[model samples]
Target: MSEQEHWDRETDLLVIGGGAAGMATALVAALEGLRPLLVEKTDQVGGTMSTSAGTVWIPGNRQSRDAGYGDTEAAAAAYMDALIGALDHTGIRAAYLRTGPQAIDYLRQRSEVRFVPSGKHPDYRDMPGAAVSGRALAPEMFDGRRLGRDFERIRPPIPEFLVLGGMMAGKDDIPRLINRFQSVGNFVYAGRLFLRYLTDRLRYSRGTRVVMGNALAARLFYSLRQQNVPVLFETTVQSLVRRGGAVAGAVLRTGDGQTLRVRATRGVVIATGGYGHNAGLRARFMPRPTPELSVACTSNTGDGIELGLAEGGTVAPDTQGPGAFWTPVSVTRRADGSRGVFPHLSLDRAKPGLIAVNSAGRRFVNEAHSYHDFVEGMYASHREVPTMPAHLICEAGFVRRYGLGHVYPGTTDLGPAERAGYLVTAPTLARLAERIQVPVEALQATVARYNDMARQGRDLDFGKGDTELNRFNGDPTQQPNPCLRPIEQGPFVALAVWPAEIATSTGLQTNADGQVLATDGTPIAGLYAAGNDMASIMMGTYPGPGTTLGPALTFGYRVAMHAAGRPVDAATGNGGQP
Candidate 1:
């Protein structure tokens, strides 16, 4: 082949991965007047955002500031320190904290990105000194018409499990919506599908409009395309090209096996997501049976981390990385082999008729904690069992309210659920326990004690009354105690549950500028990482909501800012003045 043929393309910034971080970096770079090239393993853009509700849990963000909520960079950092405690990486936190507002500003100014605060959602308080609100932000709902033809290619994040329009609402707002449940406004609010269908039909023939997660992906993708940022789909980066102790370029292989030597003038940003689908990496990091509850994209194979490591990058030794933190949730599969994994609490939340119990025939948790706590508790709950599978005990009433799994009211799967052995129903707790293979006497004793506590209006053992969210999901009409509603009626059901993780965190460590770090803690020149490819700066715990996607995007912007040699904001100390 001619030398000209070997050199396919060259650009100022080469972005590996098409996820939230990768696109953010590339878009920012393009806006800064640099030629940005993005390569995605999948055929489309969006990454996990395409499959997520797309909320950005940003503490002290511009949205919060606009809402008259006071927040400073120092306050954000303080919150971080309190949350992560000893595991906190100051440099990484500094980078995210400083660049957050700038990133939001950059996107809003240069792209179709527009966000609104899901007002009143607080930081997870159990993390030391967490706050109540003035933190979380989400993309203002958008019409799918923005994507036009691209709409069919991406997956919308699942909002069906939660209440209507509640995908990005703050924790405080949840109560107001719930309180007004039986009202006319509440009926309209709850009828999201009906509203969506009517609006789309009137506006456009394509009744599929992007909102929340899909909106985020569409907005970024729109910005990326407008800026003429080159996105090469079905192309994967094989390895890094090193020269003068710095990354010079990358060796890329297209789906057709055409090798392209693309040179990078400034740097290469690796945002190729986590290693959730790679079973081999899962065994190494998780070292356990992570049965399929992880909702992460199948394309997340840790390729970016692998390529970076080959070039002398130091991988963080945190078990909190991908495959480790995500619980392998048990899900009901469709005939086409697709499965629906609701973070578990959604079933317990709005449905009001199910309770989660462990192998010991006893309720383990409040069953309505936030997704972070629910997954964490599941991991802990597994330690007490032999196979580590909890039976999701539900009733006929629960199924009738929320619609079982993918087996909606009238589906064929519902028929199976009705069959003899699939769902078990008995008159007494002892009979139900006996059928499900639990100790009958132990089950009866546990229920009686729980009933007594319910009569007294307190959960002394588990402290269930700590969160208002828990109380909301519990029966409100019930007298003294809402959460203590006994499973007295017949017709019971149990679905085996497991720990399914969404993404892995184990990846290359990076500096404040999102530059990949070497073994000696030196920043690798011309190399950067974001998203699951980089070691999560947040340590093992999720701070609030949107913990993963929020930093991924902020760091992506930082990488672009650094690459373009832009002046950093003096007030926040994020990007240094060129």
Candidate 2:
């Protein structure tokens, strides 16, 4: 087996983790005349990406230009300069800005991975050069039947993201589903979706008309299957084997408890996500009084980062702002009593007639800003007040119109949410404040002030609907300000929100070639990292909608190209042998 190049013991590249970055590495490596093998400790693939929105922020792509988006390299640079505001890591940024388009083009042409321009997505920040839509690309939906029986191997979306028991409801489908009775087109679409789901439920555990992250994962899985690449599931890389002071292979523990030493001649890519789920790392790097919730998969317990560190790599030091990308999450008890961690990413936070309040029922930040900014407000307000478990206050009318977190729109009976302890409801604001344990007088005062500001068409406390991002997420039908509406309706409700990570930006330090760097700033010859395992190119600042995924997929391509004996050519935005 060791003598044969194609057997289990030998391969050109050994990729650890079945997430996007690792899959991208192996797929690209296979395309470049290399024999690659991927080993994932988790039984199923995709990791945290399976539950994500699956938008990739790529500038100067062909798809966006074709969609009439006016995005340019110069404009993107200005946007980055405004958000990052430093000359640090200029080379890496330049490389990413150069290699991104090439990476997307490569995968689209050679593999099953395909992305299209999001019709109306906007940057998280409305700064200079922030085009409304061109920069963020969404993965095209893929059919799970393409994978045959392997469809079961792809991880499902977050349970709360599904509707009608096991049917996935993407953001694009929600509006149509909600308005199905109002429009014939929507009714037809909704009917078709339900029919497909009903048929799929008979054969599959969940509906297979997958979208978002599930689609992306299914596409990657299909591509690897087509290429005949071997991905050993439920396999753990116990220790890295080094030869001539460079990583050459790893000792692995198979799912059935068999030990195997696999040898790699090319390189090793660590893409097991970040330390988002690691308790010790959360204490070391996250905010004090450490957050107990994470949106990342539980398998992402700092495996890749720790592996890189043991191989002489250092944690990236150029990070700024929050180490982890933050979002407000709500907890619910599933049917079987398991905890359901639902991340509030762009569903209902920025809508009209809703306001986020601290423990004292006082408004703190702009409700229409980015989720990252929303969590930053939580941390800031927590300094002087107890804001850890803030409540998103809204009326029953707000719930019927916009829904509150996991509670679907038009939910008349609040008994289910109340019984599950997921929502608080009362007949009046005073009762609601008492129920949620906030000051009743402060709650009344805050509501009155907010209503006044809404009627006056301005936010006196914090500019709510001021930014382009804010207005984009708001209800456009509202006259004065799309994000402003008085909470005058009764049967008030409140959903508890807590700070949690959507992704970790601080990770293993690496060079422009995507090779992990030693503590002294030298690249490790045969060790590479990507996805969240690699240090964020944005210096921990989330500049736009798909910031994390954009760099993640791009660096995955960069590292794989490097291992294929070709680094990116800065001038041409493609690879060249050095």
Candidate 3:
């Protein structure tokens, strides 16, 4: 049959969404000798991992397998259960834990993707059964220039957390950040970032080659090319075509509005991310007054989720479960009137002795908790009070010493929000509280209570004195009470904070191998989902470390292997890498 008269294109596998998961899936399929077509709607790839911190928390990972650390599946399972508590689902959790190591090992051996242990970044639980040091893995830095013009398409790391130019930081460097003389390593690291920027500018006419997010994505993109994977950017899967209740192929739409019907001989993998960007889905699942903020890629809009739902798949935690969303982040408007969001609270919670309170004049959680925990509490608080926003309170010392975490357009040279004062500032705690519309007396009393505790060298109200991560954000110059010092300096500030959905964890339900399943427990033949597009295997709970990317890549590989008919290695219990 003529090419145009017959099916538009035929491939063994069609992987949608070119993020970490989709890229990994296509790579595996290509390696398995299956011609794979990768569809990424965005101009570039690397979804959130490209523009954000590229850490993949894989418990009992092979990265630490040689360090003499014990990381059995049982141990990892226990750690997950402890961290997420009664909220986690055992079946899905077990699959994630058991398959994690093999997943890491497969990627390491087969692709340019490499990881190093995130030393000292503790599990959400300091609990037993957790690998003390091997639980987290971040992408080793890669040069973005390798992708050529594709490098320009990929999203670079946001600069708020990026001190010099690099957007990643060592786990131990969190606390040592504020200590000017003491943070010699951070200083040297900053110097290296600066050097990376200069080198990239001279060689590639781009300043982002050495950074974390773009670098990681660039590596995966390059590796996918080397493996001969067919990546089709600026293209989208319009709908999944079915034959006898099985996915047959997809109706694809190109940037030029050309429609092509491609046959998926094996399966169609949907890693198109969740519906965070879709207002209708967000309103349906999330509680009312859901702000239109998303830290995830703009490209994620439930395209895969919608297609799966239309194909009669069930989406679980569909209505509830921590709302299973990424937290609202602090952002400022740029000169172009675009907003830049930053997740770093290193100074606010750690060094500036800032106290976060809701609109109702109360502290809801330990301000020093992980970013995810903070968002969960924000969601809960918004539900409790009909109020639309929360406040981040910091004092003069915080702004003067640590810098009120600035958000810039593309880089620092572009317009920043710090100059705009979307970050509200005031002379007194009372004035700051009043300006932000919180009850003044209540705010003062809260600060006074914190000050009393700080002077006594303790934190009785909240366990701020607990972790090194907390102390890193504390005022070490204040003696005895590093994290306990209250926001006492003359000028205090409070920013209007809201919970921005980075990506919804709640999504289409899938089985152990990343195959979408009907409510009756039968697999949807020739259909698969991964990344934020797939239902979170951890249930509604966020596990410690690289919770997002871990399952994303793992399941991506699983779907490709299954599609390619690769044998499952019974000994390793890992399905063969495609």
Candidate 4:
């Protein structure tokens, strides 16, 4: 243990983790005239955010209003009430609703972080409180070149999510690239993107024009750099230092194996990503038959939660949903020997000719449902049979047009994937079922039923393409039901997928001000939490896109304002400026 006498450095605010929440905290604190120090366990800063779509689910934000979508705090509250009863988590939800828009306003006005409404992206569920559109917002494309050499410090997107070796394609870019050969406009678009990517490779290690979460992370990083905030990568908090019943500082361990005590006059904020990768914590907090796959950052091992717990912070109780955000992910080993966990968010599952089946070869879920609901369906199916690893079955035409998992569309070669056992391929549905170890007759029956439904453009059993969300991810060019297509082609393919977590919902309990609270429902003075370190305001139910990030940014803003002694707006729950 290092001696307290050897104090190395000090700051007014110490922010742990380098994701959206942590960076937001540090950035907001700095804007409030506080000297803040940010430390990251990994060499990079983005954490799991780099791998995401970078959508923030803040209802009634300026983006939505400006885009002519009429939404209100009351309306959003109504939706929340419908989704997860009105009485549950009323305070947290109210805090989020009030502060979220203000947080967006602050970031857009003061920092490089800019967001726009995600056009027509609907809420995850079609319940009473759901909005048809205009709730989710996504970060605009950011030029990573603005960060100069620091751009390298931004964690790149997941390898499987990229296209053409290292180039990142945004949501719009996907259709352009997939249809490049079909239309002149798409060809030009694809050509421009590839040419830019090729030119970028000549100088930078990766493309400089980034989108999605990479854009969001890079924008925040650029903001931090502009603010002169000291971000120390490869450094992590070992433990919190308590003095007179309050958190005073932290003992940090550097990448070089040196320990240093750093004191914070204002407070220390724990934004450490989450416990998604911590086996012990997962076994304890997560549901039984815990998922082996995690789409979160590798460094997210519940370090912040553990540190908070050491200081007497308590975890939020499990309620209606799983303690973590769930997704179905397919795993593949890259040529470099690294395992790639490809989260099935919106790429293929809902794209016309695909169906996810259990070991009994029965379709158990609405394939076009949101990723969270899809995994929930997986768990529900698991209760009935061995569905821990469900198989995503698709036909050759589907694979050729829409792709499966990391295997991109129009890929000329299936030999490598087949040899690597990532994909099970067969000429017939029965043979494919045999290859994947599912019952042949059951698979045949399931496909027959699915085919009959597809022809009529109706999914009677599961309602696959009924919702706006389902249609959004479906093939728009398809007739009748965009998500309904028969799998009559030969060479059927099956990829095994398992339930995976993106972020933990149950975490250190915090108040509306982001103050870390003890089990007795009292604040632990000078201790704060944001991001996954703070218990989710949604109470484990994912309402829409950006649910994790919206509250994270809002609470992060609240925490900084409270710590800096800035004037918080009573009506809006934000600080200083409106």
Candidate 5:
């Protein structure tokens, strides 16, 4: 058969991966009159996004203006300038800032993806341009029932994030659930959430009322279904099709053993979720003593980066932090033998009555730092102290009030976690230190010193509740320093945590328009990249909430626009040399 005869399918655009970026690309392509096909390696859509908080950081968004923040695009740019010291990606950074709000607006009008400004959600940093609430948009709860049978294709949220085994709950729900017994209104709200979940469980695998990243992904999936977009789940792109020295299409391998060749008239876009699960790439890119854990989907094994390299593409170098995005994670063995990697985001770490200590039982970081910065602290502390597997010390009251890592608040019974060796408990501080293999005397002194400072409403050592961001995430009900409280009650509990990546900063080099760039620092025609597959616009520095997803969706939209012969900015981005 001839070359054209071997083409099993043909399309205007071939998109790899079904994460937020890939899904948006296909959707926008269709809207722009380009026939696009999206192929996901897993049986479901939503890569890491489905398991995330799904907050999109788009400054100057309509919701922000309506909410009275009225942040300007210039102010956002100034914030980025103040936050990121390196100017390595100035061109793309400008593009992201310029187009991010537009992308959000585009999706709001054309797709089922709806977002509401999260009330009082502050930026991770209190930078000059950072607003207290308007910039961060939380996904609106999406009713999975809208997708019908295709609802099953939407990946469920992290098993641990669910309430009552199948019900989805937001960060707002947790505080209410914790205070449910204290208020009739809170009790009614909690009861209604449970009731809705129970009703949905009668017919669905999980509650159809999805929020966060699950809702965001589900909304995208529903929107695509509405447009009749062809989404090939359980399929992956094995290799890129090169024609006339440019990426034209790909060889797709289905979940079954079948291989099919697909040719694209416009080009191919790679958004394969980056190298989080790729052993070789992890070894090559991650820091020394490479962490063996990641919370991202297993299907994200650097397929896009590898494919891009075959066409002379280079992996963009990150000047700050590690190539991978950092998060302090606790490992838990599930009932099915698979282990759960739980990233300690805004929950337990920042709440009062908890202290994270190195192996020597000495306090290190503020603990209220952002998850990325928290892991960075772990690495820095580990250089002198064994900060790896640092233990978070708390008490019964602490867990009851705020919970630890995967442990839920108001959890009276710690039997399951204790029996599984996931949590260590002791009636006294010395005993708990002994149980966790930390110096007993050192641990006792640490707790005593901490209690003294906490009683004064101060973290003398690390200044835990100093930053606006820290106070925002801390327990608001607490007096004085919300992130500072004595951990004096027994039986004290301990949960071990280690640094792990939730995503990657390093990826295939791509221009502002999302076209994958060759080693010569020129755009390779018929090729584009987005999501974690594209080098981060932040240049490896995380500035605020939804840092990853905001740019992922923005650049994804830009890619689709460029693919459809409509570049968001007429000027091609500099796409800085590697």
Candidate 6:
């Protein structure tokens, strides 16, 4: 590799990683009248945020209040106290609680980012601090055409999440499009969306209208561009430049194998999207039998964490839970020979007429639980029996209505999926057990017990639909228990699911100001971390929809303010007392 000797660039602030946190850092710095340079290792921006649902769980945010929810800071604090319960990172938690709404307000007022509270989205656990709704906020849908030619620079969502090869849909769009056959209004709404998508395809390589995480990423990307913050794609930091024991800049390596020295006068922010794909780090930090599947950006291989560590930053110690965010994933090989891991996040698992059984063909968990909780069940089940590859068995009618994994609902052609061995089908329950390699009698008895409970509209075995969290992701239109329909219909389908990580909870330790801290509990000057690169504020607890993103945005804002020598008042948006 050819390396350049002289300084190739200079800026007030340098933000590494193009995901939400990095973008927020650069955006805030630019807004504060500093010249910011953002670098992304990938060919495009958006990192793992582009592939997510784009929701941020920010308690006491204005959007929630504006949406007529009575969520207060005290309520949020009480909830956190109940859930976190004497963790060491209370300072980070306090900072997040105080600054989260401020961050949202700043972004809404100054940037293109717009968030609307998911008024009905419940917290992940039904603990004392949990809210039934109004804490999670999602980015409003964005029109990709606004970006013009720059639209191509925004990383697209996962291929499996799209419809008709390109169009991105939101949570609400799914039911509308799927139920179009039942209602004329739904049919027209879906028709218009498809029409818009088809027209967009004629002009662009993919649909120009985007939603969810893609939209959130696009909004941030648009804001950065609008602020004239320069972002270098396919560029990464090789090493942090230190002067007087403080990070001064970085030695950057470009995609063409050329290296250049870049100086930052303010600070360098590390936002590389965690260590999800780094095998060595995973083996060290994760629980035994480390997950091989990750839904995070493939480029996220712990570059930022390693860089911070090399610069004398400390990693947070292990907590009560696994130091990684997890989800159950189903894999499919595309025609192009690339494997696609579809995360079972609120699509089919929580809905009625579904049951997840281990290799012994026994039900082990409440099927309607959150994805993180579902993986916990897998881990627990694995301790007893072989449950690494659990099967999500659903009836033919459920498959036709709700779809399993990557298989779409009302799919006329199962030829491609069947050829790829992604979908296992059997006309009888015994046959399904045989095909999936589970015991026949065990499977039959499990379904029989489940059917009796479903008929009574109650889950006596595991209380599947008992909690608000379970019902939140379920089909509300169902009679009696929303998440408890019987899976008695034949021509059954079963999709194999594996433990997969969505994000790493363990990361570089940082203080309340988002400054990277040393092992001796002192902040490393001019060094900061945000997004998944920073140890999670929740301390590995899956609080709600946007726990990762909420802290990411808040700390990104904090890092920029601290670097700019601005006062950070957590109580108000304008740096004032409440």
lDDT per residue for candidate 5 within 1-578, as digits (tens), equals 78799799999999999999999999888888889999999999999999999998888888878878678888888888888853744388887877887888888887788899886777777778777777889999888888888888988887778777788888778879879889999999999988888888888998999889999999999988888889888887888888888788899999888999999999999999999999998888888778988988888999988988887888856453588778999988776878887889988899888889999999999899989888888988999988899999989788877788788888898888899878999999999999999999999999999999999999989999988889998988888999999988799999999889989888888888888888788999899999998888776677888988998899988898888877787555311101
Ranking by lDDT: 4, 6, 5, 2, 3, 1
Across 432-532, the per-residue lDDT of candidate 6 in tens digits comes to 99999999999999999998999899998888988998887788988798898988878888889999988888989888878999989898988999999
Cα lDDT for residue 373, candidate 6 = 83
Model 1 agreement with the true structure over 1-578: per-residue lDDT tens digits:
86445556788989999988998989888888899999998787887777676778676688788888776777767777886664444466776776787788767866888788776566654554465666777876666666677655455455433333323333333444554456877656646644665665665443455566667888888888788787788999888887688897899999888999998989899998877777766667663455555677778887887888888898756545333445425555433555556544343532344556677777776655665566666666666754356666655555554444433332223446545233455556666787778777866676666556756766676655456545545556755655555554656656666677656667778877788988898889999998888888776666676787788888888888889987354354645322
For 184-268, candidate 2 gives per-residue lDDT tens digits of 9999999999999999988888889989888988888899988999999999888888878898888899999988888888888
Across 1-578, the per-residue lDDT of candidate 3 in tens digits comes to 65335578888888888888888888878877798999989787888877656777777776676765546677777766676554543266666766767777887888887877666555554466655567777788776666766667666666555555443444344435444246678677656655767776665545654445565687788888788787787998888888777898899999889998998888888888788778887877765666667777787887888998988888866433644455647776655777877664344555536677887677776677666667676767777863446777776556555555563212222113335756776778777787888888888888888778767877787676576556544666767857666667776667766667656777878876778888787889988888888777655565566778788877777777777776343454557743
lDDT of 4 by residue, 145-166 (tens): 7888898999999888777768
Candidate with best lDDT: 4
Off by over 4 Å in 4: 1-6, 88-90, 567-574
Candidate 1: misplaced stretches above 4 Å?
Answer: 1-6, 68-75, 86-90, 157-207, 287-293, 319-323, 337-340, 345-354, 399-428, 468-484, 567-578
Global lDDT of each model? 0.68, 0.86, 0.70, 0.89, 0.87, 0.87
**lDDT score, residue 502, model 3?**
58
Clash pairs, model 6 backbone: 79-129
lDDT of 2: 0.86
Off by over 4 Å in 2: 1-8, 317-320, 570-573, 576-578
RMSD of each: 4.5, 2.1, 3.9, 2.1, 3.1, 2.6
Error of 1 at 491 (Å): 2.3
Q: Using alpha carbons, what is the TM-score of model 1?
A: 0.86
* Model 6, residue 53: C-alpha shift (Å): 0.9
Superposed Cα deviation of residue 50, candidate 6 (Å): 0.8
Off-target runs (Cα >4 Å) in candidate 3 are: 1-6, 68-70, 83-90, 126-132, 159-196, 202-205, 318-320, 345-347, 384-387, 407-419, 467-482, 567-574
Count of steric clashes across candidates, in order? 20, 0, 8, 1, 0, 1
